[model samples]
Target chain A: MSAPSSSSLSIRDLHASIGDKPILKGLTLDIPKGEVHAIMGKNGAGKSTLAKIMAGHPDYTVTSGDVLLDGESILGIEPDVRARLGLFLAFQYPMEIPGVTIANFIRAALQARLPEGEELEATDYYAKLYSKMDALSVPRNFTSRSVNEGFSGGEKKRCEILQMAMLEPSYAVLDETDSGLDIDALKIVSAGVNALRGPNIGMLVITHYQRLLDYIVPDKVHVMSEGRIIHSGDKDLALKLEAEGYDWVEKEYSAGKSAV
Target chain B: MTTETKPDIDIDRSVGDFRYEMDYAFDAGIGLNEATIDYISDVKGDPDWVREFRKEGYRKFLEKPMPTHWATKDLENIVFENIRYYLSQGQVPKRTWDEVPDDIKKTFERLGIPEQERKFLAGVEAQFDSEAAYSNIKAAVGEQGVIFVGSTEGLKEHPEIFKKWFGKVIPSGDNKFSALNSAVFSGGSFIYVPPGVKVKHPLQAYFRINAQNFGQFERTLIIADEGAELTYMEGCTAPKFETATLHSAVVELVAMKGAKIQYITVQNWSSNVFNLVTKRGIAHEDAEVKWIDCNIGSRLTMKYPGVVMKGKGARGEVVSIALAGDGQHQDTGAKMIHAADNTTSNIISKSISLGSGRSTYRGMVHVPKHLKGCKNNTECDALLINSHSRTDTYPAISVRGQGNAVQHEASVSQISAEQIFYMQQRGLSEAAAMSLAVNGFVNDLVQQFPMEYSVELKRLIDLEMEGSVG
Candidate 1:
């Protein structure tokens, strides 16, 4: 297999696990800049595990493999350091940080990225934050609310997108960004993500259903089975998987591996 | 008394190897007696009424036994007879900073009170040992009928109002420490907001301990009149000494109808100081009272600032944060007693322990059977920074009324290395990451503090984080 050209995030032979249980076995994928990539899989198919491993989550240990951020291996870096290196993960379940406002949370993340002794300008920070919130269709007053605390499912998803848009990471993995969102909220969030698409940013959208693809319209789709990508194709693969279901792909992948 | 010029005392000898010690000129003596009390009263040129009050308080002190059972047990061992009750360099407190003696001025200057007051504080009262060496109020605030003066001066100028409520809330014999404070208390704050007036800025007082083996007992009382509001802040720092010094203080607050009073205290005594304080407040109809208390340093501290909701529809809140470092035990909490119908009270406490430090939360919320529609909520969260640290929560809530509601929640959490690693990987050093996580743990309560105080609180957390790494 040849490496995908123009890739900003490349996961090669990725193997990760929590304790003795292996979650991802030799999973490999590549996300190029200026394009949206979707990974479709069943539960426990290493979809969420891949996102967590890429974000340097402490709970999951990488047994063997490399996750490259901008062509640099980031397997040993810390989660926050991974974040500073332009890797963003929109958690499927966002942690509720009480007493920390959404605006302050995003501001702290942005501040963490700045060079030491260089203070963040309050005026410019607020101006940019307000513009991002407006683009996300979030209320201006949501800035003062606690991060994800008391928020509805759709609100949480939108908040995740808002954070992604503010951070402006080089590569973003939206883990189930469409899981809990209603139709209207899904559209707003997709629109927010679409607006942020550019030459400098690459996004990997993980979802179980192809319904979100109708709105997000990924440039490439990968079918993940048994902890690895079994098939790779264009956006039509998502629609095909949506119609045929995941069982056929899982059976065929298992048969091919066994026959080998 | 004339200013005597003595040979320059060696800085090492004068400060006695204590970080908080100051070079001040004062006639030092031990024990509390008629002579010492009379000397203190006479030095201030107190009116006959104040002298009589001091004498009466002295009698009460002699009668009240040492508190041996509640909270800090070490207080029982405090040798009252061996401790000096009062020490003042000058016979009279200067009306202006320029009039203050150079030694006393230098004492406060070393404590950084004047600079802190000038930079961000609205008003400052510096107490050296037992008397207020220098006190100043912003002219703009003074013009608004806000009184920020020492307790002794309040007795002389506003005796009618001062005496009426002086010991009414926290009586002379409320506790052993209260009795001691009443008898020997020399220099604390006296704040009164006139009816319908609001003091936008916080008035601060800095108490510096300069004398060795001396017990500094300061009495503070603040009265927010009907429809008035005020925010008062106090900080204490004592030089370290081998022989521990005793500090017992009493603060009483009264919020009248439709009034609000927020009292904040940041105590940073050295590890050799025994800080035992009793602070309480009374809220009347439609009034609100809040106590934002932080206990950072002290060998043993037994302080529980509480509130009594005495009038209908009154509200009371106590948000306390305690951080106990090495060789410290912070036994602090709050008490809320609902005496009137429809009264409400809420208490939220957060404590952090590090390096064998122990923090205990002993809180009480009482709503009698007669009170209807009373409500109470109490939550306590404790974080252990390391394995050796310990934290405990003891909440006693009793509600007898059928129409009342009460809730209590307590949690103990340890700092996870995984969380720390996650933050460190984000380019933050281990120390900086831990500080952020710790600050985030208490951010809910810290954000409730006034802006300047929150900034200072964060700085204190940073200082604690220094050298915390193994």
Candidate 2:
């Protein structure tokens, strides 16, 4: 089958595997522009694998699948090319690049988008960076420090958010951004993410815990089991999953799979 | 050594890719022998003592075998018989660019030396082939009794001052390359700041070998008198017009009591050039000497700059960065010899090897048994960009003196796949990501360079990585 002709990040009947192990099987999801979505699942539910596969990571091979960015297939391009095509992945484990400052790192990303022979205005760049950093409550001096090196867990998440704000990607995937953040950190991080939400961007916030959903308040919540979406609901679905756990969803999912 | 107030990247990139055809006034026929020495001495109008000095250096060069046991076996490829020992238009240097021979002046213009001398450099001694084509100094620096001139003119004009320190810090027989430089050296800078006179701005020397098959042996001697301060930057950070198959240079620096000297070298020669150099400095009582060197883009380079602390309370430092691309090897490091009590020394060296390139860090530090209160710290770091890129570290430190403290640190790292992937996810292409990682590895030392050199080097690496990818 061909890809979806829709203005969204469309994953259609995705089947992906890492080496000999299949992780994502027949998964389908679509995130249109100007909305926030959340996916909740237990361990080994393939949530993280789906995020990586969408970003074109080399570790996973798509046995049969299609990932589209705004109605165009982005299946085989390089990760960098995919990023420039407006797909962003906030890593579950952000890399520590020694001796590379935050300012220069973001600048390179922005500079790569500019036309050849064009220069990035340093004064305006720094001013915009300072304002975004202030909104995230990240100290100004953090720009000079190496990216994610020696940074606390909270700082790493904030750094990821800062990069997202700077790049202003069209579709952003936040992978467990609240995994290590405390309550105060979560508040600040959610505020930062909320400030960036508008009619111009689509966001997929993936998390294992429902507490993160309370802060960011996704418009739609989906229950993921055995690699594919089992059920979809409003914000109340997150509360139900948080209170009664995924046992009910898992039971219903298996019954449906076995009967089929 | 040259700094453009606003560097032109196109001109900078092509600085060393173009050559000029010249009509030679003198060319010492190919090969090294007694007749060659006599011819060179006669051409320079050398005195009897100086003539004898060249002969002694020739004898040493003939006796010394290639240092292949500890160096690259490629050293055997330099055909001494095929090399023209000396080639020049004349010995007298032109004070104004217009007076310089048109061909030679065109060489310097292509090198973009005069433009770099406009704002950042206090003086310039532009070397073209075997002689200085153009030289000039700021009036304020000249008024302060700073003598900056080519080695040919320095020997003739200021013999009393030049003779006292010539070959004292690094003698002719120090190494095979040093001996070769001493025997056939021409077209290098020589500077001497008067006692207690501080040259406020750095003096730069621009070197270019425009003649093919001509072995360039530059002999540089810089002496800072008692209580004087000076910074001499050499080997201007640009590729040469035409690669000399062999480039052997000997640089000797002297820092007298309470004096300070900083020698900076940014060498980016063509890939066909084989660079072998011996550089050393002597620091007297309470004096300081620092060497900041950056080596990039050569077929094979084997150099180890050293310092000898000769008087009490002296200090020495060597901060260097080296980058090796495909089919290149950068074998470089530093040496510190403490011959006096209460001396301090520091060495920080970083290197990056890409593609199939190889880099090695070889260092030596020594403190005698009698000296007390001596301290030394050495750090070496290597970064690899590809799976086949290689690096090696060999450090020999001996400290037997009472109350002496010594320390050494080393690390080897490759740009992890995850790191590259992370950068790529941020929209940087694979080549640009690798180039930036390499740039970060050497950014600290690149900062030691003057003016916009760091900026220029970033662009150079970006271009290198793109070519490597292709």
Candidate 3:
């Protein structure tokens, strides 16, 4: 197989399935460094499957695929190892870890990235954490609360963003991060994500609505259906799909498939 | 205290788990019989009544059958005749670390017991195998009219207090294991706080089982007089042996009127030992008795530390954490018996099972009719590392009184795939994620332990979680 761009997260013809039920069928996409791309698809369109597959969720088996992280294949690695290699997945539905404080949970994650025998600098970590939390408008007391336990939907999303800010990953996949947030929360969360946007990192914003695009606008957009990216366009494509709905794209995809 | 001259025990000092070889000056070799009891009594020069008391205990042990109808059938594996009930290097306990034997001192040093004693303990009693090697109390605490010494020394020196409450709380006929411990009871802590005397620092006891095919029966008795308060902590560990090692201890506590006694135990037996202990305390009027226990690394452990509220307005609590690794079963819980009006009790137990390990929580709360205004709250939470791990909860609450409330809440949870995956996505390995989840399951209960113990407990849990996940 020819190597893709070394500075991008290249997913080439990724085919995966849960048990015998196929999910991602020859899905191919790329988000190079210094840019953000959005994937728009309805429910059960394999958008979430793609995100979970990249993180190596045990339930999904990759029939054939190549996921390159900066010229290195991370296809069969452990999820944590892949994460340490700079691939982060912000879950659509975050888990509630009872009794684990958000501060300690994130601290452990950061510590895992450090070299053996190296200790995290407490004072520096706290300073950075406090600043990021302040930006997200998360209360200072949330640092001591159990991670996502008894938290509102917005709080969970903000915590996911907080972890991303602390990690500063090379590549990030925001899986439906905009789903469970009201307009007020969406603005704060979008601002948090936008603050993290820069030339050093690549991001894939996966969502079903164009509303999120109005806030954290993506440089490029793609329409995913039936486990594959059927159509690709610029940011205006999202607005067109929002105005005309996926029926137009669905018809076009069927016509393209029938023609082949 | 007589010091016997013998060859030094030779073993690798760096490997704390290696058992040192030594010849016991007093060894009531293999078996439980009348002769063994007589030999032990003769060795200790026990008075007539105490000697007869042990004989009666041995007879009772033979009469009571093991409680296996509802428990695991593994109880049949313990060979009474093959166990060495008594083995000791020296009969007399040393008053100073310098006078303690080199082998025993090295063991305690490796465990960091002496350093902990110096830093935070008011007194420390280090028991090795069948006898206390060293027992000492801080001068200031001693001046405050507190008695801290080995059980043997306490029985001989302060029999008026020790003999009165020795087996009053948990008698020989309480259970099969308790009967065995009573018949062959040896070195354990005996503490007494005088009226109105408050112990500033905790008194600690460290027990080590260093011999194979041995049954360590250490009996402990603690009493807090009226208006007195004290905290006692106990920790135990044993070397890995091919054969099963038995550790059965009977501990009785007495909290007099308005007195408070807090007992903390961190039991870290090797996977080759069976740890069965009976611990109970009596709380008098306006008294409080709290038990904080942590169980780790035992082949099989059955311990239920209980409190009997005998006086009005007495408060009882039991906070416990048990971790069962491979080939381990931790059957532990709490029992609260409210015998008087306006008594209250609370039980919080958390357990983690890994690698096909099993943990059982069996609780008993009894508030009979005619007892007014009694209350109890029980919360049990179990965390499983994978599908193979197992946990069970059996809570029997019998409340037939007016104005009484008893509540029990139990939950069995596995570290969900999504939970682990979420943590893994944040960069933790599967094992670290599982370990964190397990730690979180018991984080609230850990706060009930001492600062030093909670830190050590977290480290121990982390070590146990290694290689638990694929």
By TM-score, the best candidate is 3
Give each model a TM-score.
0.83, 0.96, 0.96
Q: On a 0 to 1 TM-score scale, where does candidate 1 land against the true structure?
A: 0.83
Which DockQ-derived CAPRI band holds candidate 1?
incorrect
TM-score (0 to 1) for chain A, all models? 0.96, 0.97, 0.97
* Tens-digit lDDT string for candidate 3 (A220-249): 999999899989999999999999888888
DockQ of each: 0.22, 0.78, 0.84
Q: Global CA lDDT of candidate 3, please?
A: 0.90
The fraction of reference interface contacts (C-alpha pairs within 8 A across chains A and B) present in each candidate is 0.32, 0.73, 0.86
Tens digit of lDDT per residue, candidate 1, span B252-367?
89999999999998888877789999899999999999999999877789888899999999999999999877667888999998999999999999998877678999999999
Candidate 1, fnat value? Answer: 0.32
Q: Can you tell me the CAPRI class of model 2?
A: medium
Candidate 3 to truth, TM: 0.96
By DockQ: ranked, best first: 3, 2, 1
DockQ of prediction 1: 0.22
